[model samples]
Target: MTAGTANAQRFREFKMPDVGEGLTEAEILKWYVQPGDTVTDGQVVCEVETAKAAVELPIPYDGVVHELRFGEGVTVDVGTAIISVDTDPGAGPAGAPAAAAAPEQAAAAEEEDAEPQGRQAVLVGYGAAPSSTKRRARKPQPGVPAQPEPVKAQLQAELNGRPAAVPTPAPVAPAAVPTPAPAAPVPPAARPVGAGAAGRPLAKPPVRKLAKDLGIDLSTVAPTGPDGIITRADVHAAAAPAAAAPVAPAEVPVAVAPAAAEPGIVDTAARERRVPVKGVRKATAQAMVASAFTAPHVTEFITVDVTRTMKLVQELKQDPDMAGLRVNPLLLVAKAFLVALKRHPEVNAAWDEARQEIVYKDYVNLGIAAATPRGLIVPNIKDAGGKTLPQLAAELGDLVATAREGKTSPAAMTGGTVTITNVGVFGVDTGTPILNPGESAILAFGAVKLQPWVHKGKVKARQVTTLALSFDHRLIDGELGSKLLADIAAILERPKRLITWS
Candidate 1:
């Protein structure tokens, strides 16, 4: 309805709150409201997953939700108004004061007397409702797939065209069932009549669209919809008709050399296939481009005989104390990085654009660059400089595990002063690593392998590894950069030197 047609209201915007201390940003894991959805104060409006955990954030004010800025999985900063509430926002609930009661109000009453009769407690705070709920992952059932788990349940409002009302719960029920997605795989508490046969939930418009594009059916296909919302893929599968030509099995094309072609590797496939730059991959490319072009990058390489370091890893693995721990060359390489940082603190710093200066950190928030199913996430351990060898080793293992499982939060990936890229894990000797945006330097740890080397006047096999440092030349001069690289090389040369120098 047009504002002038009947009634129009000016609504106040509810900005994303800092749910926890020092939490400046959060990813909008799911939106519970779209514009025009009614919501009550203290009701859950959306679920945001912070670095530490997923939390269900409540609505700060009551009203009809007027708009949402983006789709689910959007990362937003504190103070960014994510939803608009069109109503009397500052108004308090049913009979409470205009604002939440202040602690001083209660304290003032105590000071009056044992029986402070007739004297009213003066409340002097804004009428904002107290938030009792905390942040958490989006609500999901057991054995549910990750992709189809739309920002359903825990949302007080509905998005786009989905119905917002939920079935009222019965008092005598064994347990309350969550509201079902209309045409999703997981049926509602009780499947509705006239739904898909075999008791499957029906598909929604978008899901139907997806299925149509994929050549699927709506009624015949099994649903993979959130809250029983029919997914597009399911619809397409159902819509797709079986073909008579499919009666024959597909023959495996045996790879054979062309009769008249050259004997070398055939051009069966293109050397490279172009993929659309979208989603996380596209965003990564953009961030890299911005950093590479804007920041003056200088690449430096140092080949080190890390034979002793490799041997130490094996010894640590067999040691009783390190039995349960995950011990690998990465641990020793990480130790070498710390040693190098202590010798050269300036290398472990970033160029602060907002402050218009170089910010040198006393503690190392060591970021270990990890490639995960979600994308590349560099979750770092804060104050890594102070942690002991064993503590750091355990922390690294936990960080890698969390990242690989698609559970690494944004907090884990931010506030990194320096980054260590383990290109060696990919079996590559070395490549000029890209600096993690704000950070001035990034170190690349390459593979360790036996190579012929001249040591003690004899040509013998030694565990050789290459160290590559990529720095922002605009911040780190060539001489300082070279010295930093050399210090890392020197530490790897003599492991005992770290005991003294570090």
Candidate 2:
């Protein structure tokens, strides 16, 4: 922070800078300091991931970290006050330690302090310093793979004790957009009142507009999409539904204006809609784009009969000890992956371009691709291979909530050796997913549905699901991916196999 006429007093704060090389805002991933933690210059005081890579942010000013403005994963725009520092402002070209504050700011602080006898310390950028240039680049992981399918390599690296490198998420077009046609309207499938509205609500303005444009009401639109979202098609269809009334001009404007306004805002949107391409999406996009074009990508699909696993979900629920806890097929699947990962550790490794090597991992900080209000973020469970069923489920739950609330810190999203996408939650039966950079593979879980199957010599209703594995052909071959995918399916097919394997 530059000094004003009051430079003799000294610098009182350090604000977060545009750290994405030129990016404007970043989610506060995590804070390593509270108000009074004494810190040295260059000591990592926080971990903030831009949309791309997980970045460990170091303190630029040495001082006691005064008040943390927000907790982990709070997105802060550039120039926002992050911490305050006590700096001896060197003679400002004129041998005198100037007050490190703007005259107006110093006066304001003085007034604020006099009233409450307490330092609310809310000058916005009271304790701020110019961000260090060093923090510009996120530290590269050890032995990162250049292969297209690095998600698996991420897992393998953990198993082999290698550091994971996540390419940052690709930058999404920064213009604020109304929800897409398919992504419009939140579900009417019934949720606790106002429970899931904090993050990105599923409804897009246009779809909402369409509903109003056609005289359909929002509550009346039975959402057919996940998270109770009402899609554009649903709105259009509902417009023609029987019992719909004549369109009202006033209500139609909110929905339709957004579409017209969206473009104008994009063209004239604050110079440019600036976004930080760091953290999970940023890292994932950079790595995937780099890998997809540089390294070859190969994907495989498998259909499995997970009837027993669904039955086991019920059995686990019946246990008195399991009461009050949420237990589902994912917990079992997570366990199965751990078991499978042990057998095919090769699947959880990365190809290092700098050294021309393939590195493997020993533990799994299994990442789950979570769609949050801030965009897609992946907060992984550290050392997931060691957690028990209940623990895993609980952690997953917390991770989901954190991401949805935009509270996922940079550290939480870092160091994942493997990842799983529960597309099943979205009613998706299959998808060829993208790989997280630096790791070897990625797994997608499809919806578990009831289907006819042969059981005990007779046809019976059984739960079934499909699994899709996307791998980096540079490091993983069809044979290896098949082995890993088959191993996972085998365990999900029979939970008892876990015991045998263990």
Candidate 3:
């Protein structure tokens, strides 16, 4: 038929999708499109934060945005319609058929507005239609006086003495409408621009939580995000001044200081703070606790002189092939681990309790443990067994960067066969790192220090470090564990087995 009729029939609704497997809900972090904006299929419409990670949702059909059902910061259940669109390409706001149907549409809109919105799972891109059953208005209870409709109606009846002759009294004057008196001025502390005076500050829940942990007031921190929202960087910047504030001199006076140093006495009320366990930290904690108790753990340690590995790192940094990549001892250690894994593939297997069997993976998804502001996350490099030295270094650098920025995807953190955690960066000599859940083993690399050791029967200073390998006793016996640890150490000590072994 006509374009107007076609436009009215082409409206569609897009429901939220399950971005990650088994995830029930996601909080809308930001909206990229508003009503009346043109959108295409596969265009990102909004960003949502799930329990595992933040993800962007793309629309599945081309359309002009008709309505946004929810606002940012709302935690919406999966499969709920968040937006509606008019899918007809040529549809405009001034379409004639829509205007002609205004009266019927208005009645329907009123009915819909009277009902409370409830979350119900619907197919993606399909929204539930408006309920056909209309609700009747509540009647006055017995013995209760009914409220007056309005003063204007009663006044107009009084002015017209005879009902038969009375015409609808002239419409009430606009100025005659009674309005409530102005509210009292709010206090300054309760009237901060971004928060108190208007409404809640424009910040995601995670950012707000971060500000709370850092003890930074969101109202005081200037927002730099789109639409004047507060972001993670803004909170960190607000906390910077407090962290950098200089401490008072010792000679100032013992009484003037904030508190005195004491031995074996901790003021838990003042010195301690508690943070809610949730998000990445909560998941990590639950997994660690379960893995530690379910699987019998056996840790083996070995001390080796890594002087040769350090020299190799320096040489690689200068080599033309690796000139632009990140060259460090971790690179060499990772390479050594990969070479060792090839020789002992048994170490790359997992104990499947449900199947009651050992599952050996042919490919290696090597996990690297990273400490981020959020918590500890292990994001793995997929198929790390097949990459060359430079390729491995590049992937390692990218993994570390993504983890530190809290941008690691859920897929990147799964399917790990083995893991490595470097405790060396924190200046620790050694640590017994727990195995990542679903993985067979984790290698902990400790601080490499220059120590006096006997070399060629002569005392000399050498770069030496201790490595701790923690594995599942259920699947890996002591012999297999010792062999894997010894292989890694040998590669690091000699720096030539990586070539020969590979």
Worst 10 residues of 3 by lDDT: 121-130
- Write the candidate numbers in order of decreasing lDDT: 3, 1, 2
How far residue 107's Cα lies from its native spot in candidate 1, in Å, is 49
Write model 1 residue lDDT over 1-502, tens digit each, in one string: 3322212245567787776546677766666766768899898888875543456778867777765643454567789767767675454422222234454433222111122354322212211112254355466554333343234432322422336655444333233554344345333335453253334334433444444434445555654443233443344334333321222333445566556756666755433344443334554676689889888999999899998877788898888877678899788778878887888787777787787988788989888988864367677998998988889889999999887776665567668888899999889999998887788888999998899999999999999999999999878899989998888888888888779887
lDDT of 2 by residue, 1-502 (tens): 2434343234456677655445666666566776657778888877665663345677777655544544454566678766665454233321222356554454333111121333222221112112233233344343342234468646534432337765564334334543222233344334332123322223444444445544567676665553345565565455433323432222221222336646654323323334545555565567668867875678888888898898889999988777766788888888898888888888878888999998888878898888865456667899999887778878888888777766576667667777888899989998988777666777899999989988889999888899998888988888988998899998998889989997
Residue 53 lDDT in model 3?
Answer: 70
Superposed on all Cα atoms, model 3 deviates from the true structure by an RMSD in Å of 14.8
| Cα-based TM-score, every candidate | 0.52, 0.52, 0.64
**Best candidate (score: TM-score):** 3
Evaluated at residue 407, the lDDT of candidate 3 is 79
Q: After superposition, how far is residue 303 of candidate 2 from its true place, in Å?
A: 1.0
Top candidate (lDDT) = 3
Candidate 3, residues 344-386: lDDT per residue as tens digits? Answer: 8988898878879889889999999999876888989999999
**lDDT at position 178, candidate 3:** 50
The TM-score measured for candidate 3 stands at 0.64
